[model samples]
Target: MKFRVKKATKNRTCIVSAAPYHPYQRCKAQGHVEFFSDFNKDSLFGVITFYQHKYENKVIVDGIFTTDIGIDGIKTSDGRPRYTAELYNEDEEMIFDLTSAVFNNAIQLVSIKKELINLEICGDEGIIGKAVVLKRGGEEIARAEVYRLDPIV
Candidate 1:
């Protein structure tokens, strides 16, 4: 008796190819290429990565200063200072009314790490709502449109 090998058939069986096995091939296929110039300096501030959790976000600020300058023969002995400067949140509703005193005589700066949520809204006629960030200064820092999807079957 003689036995013979059978070839794979489309309906009964199939052949699968392995993913790219070689490091060079894999790198070439999905590697990131960064362009650099001779003028590039390593002492730069560099790119900072900020990761936000599903519920929280962070904001970073740098190089803030507050200076007190006396004016027009005003001396420390004077009862009232000649010049006073302050920075306030343009939007008073979002935050407390803070002043230089609150910041320990330094330039008013804030670094917030707070929890947040991703909200989605929908309306009739397939009109979706958007999420907006309203800064204390009345600035819209970011906005995202909502998307809707059916539950998995």
Candidate 2:
């Protein structure tokens, strides 16, 4: 028998359009992710683009994120790559984060629907939110700024 190893590539994108009546209706957000795994190299990158509107209601997010995981990536005590994602509101307060084991799986894709409530989106500033990725017990790896979407009138 013979075994051959090849590089693996994964790409994923998420698009969100909140309902007309939803608090996030005036918000626009998109997330992109890319991961490559191979016998020789492993790299992961992600970005988030977002816009917000004024509202006191809750915001519901719907989408799925997919990516490739390399053995060389961050690992858990059980020897599994550990990748995490987090979201923050205008105040820099954490809205949510994928930290559960279920977030890290052998599967190449995962589906997620999260609701963010009690967020302060009444700001006139274009910068409304931010998405970031941090190294395991280390500094930030990457970040994306979120902006406020102007009303169409």
Candidate 3:
């Protein structure tokens, strides 16, 4: 099997709309909402096109991707919403899986080719720069880089 990977960001800050708008309007429209970076944007969400501002809020967020802001589910009280990141082979079948990932924050995995990875994350946040690997059964498939980002002023 093969896998592709990209550098992902952590604790990335971003602005979100705070108001409500009618239709066919961009986030810049009047009466729309705006939210400061009270949330940490994670790259594990993989191309977040849109997501609910709050798990119980009706607001739909077209969170900015250029700055890579928002979308990979924020810190849940009970981590109720679990995510499973899966890897597929040429036959389009899943082989490896990462279950119960915190906030289900899966990295922006490459989808063009194949790869092999090995990593450990039993007790992360202990190591300064710890990495993780995804495997299928006993075969290595992908790796994830865990790091923080400095605010770019």
Candidate 4:
């Protein structure tokens, strides 16, 4: 319903998509997003995040940014290099690994760019948005400037 963002160094622009309506009730759902950017060489430090999931009350938020996207996350517990992954709640909690999360998805990005993120959301009676939160140093910035993409394709 209401959202507030702080400010950051490298400003990133964003445009939120129109929220989808319930096929049956046609009532508006709740949703939002914020994205940020990173300039790391390891590709890990300099990365991108695209997160979107149906939370409680059927709300879906989406966004991309250059900072750490806040979500319950974990890495490989062993002594191996930890690839990043995010945990989101749906009917239950779901894990989305950067490399191999969805087996059925048609496409996958080898590297994730924290500055560039796209959301894939679907379902009936669901909510979705594109105005993602952009992060820098792990905090959501309130001064990050945002813009809209052209509506006509």
Give residue 145's error in model 4 in angstroms.
Answer: 17
* Worst lDDT 10-window in candidate 3: 25-34
lDDT of 2 by residue, 48-85 (tens): 32223235344433322233554334556675445555
| Candidate 2 residue spans exceeding 4 A from truth | 1-42, 47-56, 61-81, 87-108, 112-131, 147-153
**Considering every candidate listed, which one attains the maximal lDDT?**
2
lDDT at residue 152 of model 2 (Cα atoms): 52
lDDT of 3 by residue, 85-139 (tens): 3434334445334332221332222223212122221123121133333332444
Please estimate how well model 3 matches the true structure, expressed as its whole-model Cα lDDT. Answer: 0.29
Cα lDDT listed for each candidate: 0.23, 0.40, 0.29, 0.28
Candidate 4 Cα errors over 4 Å, as ranges:
1-81, 90-92, 95-120, 125-152
Candidate 4 TM-score, C-alpha based: 0.22
* Whole-model alpha-carbon lDDT for candidate 1: 0.23
Off by over 4 Å in 1: 1-131
What shift in Å separates residue 11 of candidate 4 from its native position after superposition? 69
Query: Sorted by lDDT, highest first, which candidate order results?
Result: 2, 3, 4, 1
Measured on C-alpha atoms, candidate 2 has an lDDT of 0.40
- Give candidate 3 misplaced runs (Cα > 4 Å): 1-98, 102-127
Candidate 4 C-alpha RMSD relative to the actual structure? 19.0
